[model samples]
Target: MAANTDETTDAELVAEIARQVPDASADEAAAIAVAIGAHLTDRQRAAAAAAAAAGSEETWDGKEWSFSGRIDATQKRHVRVRQESPTDPWSAAGRTDRM
Candidate 1:
């Protein structure tokens, strides 16, 4: 079968399920993952459409960086981040807790 391009495959999903439920047998994990995926397929499609419609973007100006996007389908969110130095990790720029 062709590999999944945009989402995890059943095998990958089963593996993750098995990892989370160590006591479950491989067959059991596979069955559960398949069922969950089937049940959520329509909801997943709707979420993808909503996220695409909401859109997101990231911008950088020297050390300052900003991202504007929906944190989830239900709300729009923005996050400002900064890098102290060329090698520094990006960090929340200001009071992002309220953002």
Candidate 2:
């Protein structure tokens, strides 16, 4: 029997196994494929949940920091916030001759 972690598709693996064991019934092969797929799906879901719970924060150039927010399907494309100072380089460019 092939190792479970070989990364072969369930259908490919089932066909290979059936070729090797001609006595195995189609129902048995199908059952094995369904079981393996379910196990892999459950493991993937658990891993994703754990990763989301361990949220990470990052800073750029040791000066600016950014945070990630979860957006649902109904949320707007952009969220607006007021800043004390303008952050647009184009707007600030006309005010100063530097650069």
User: What C-alpha lDDT, on a 0 to 100 scale, does residue 47 get in candidate 1?
Assistant: 96
CA deviation > 4 Å runs, candidate 1 = 1-9, 44-99
lDDT by residue for model 1 (1-99), tens: 112335554787898999999999998887777668666776788899989876742334543432323222224554444332222223432334544
Off by over 4 Å in 2: 1-10, 20-23, 56-99
**Model 2 Cα shift for residue 35 (angstroms):** 0.4
lDDT of candidate 1 at residue 58, scale 0 to 100 = 33
Native-to-model Cα distance after best TM-score fit, residue 45 in candidate 1, in Å? 6.8
The positional error of residue 29 in candidate 2, measured at the CA in angstroms, is 0.5
TM-score of each: 0.34, 0.40
Best by TM-score: 2
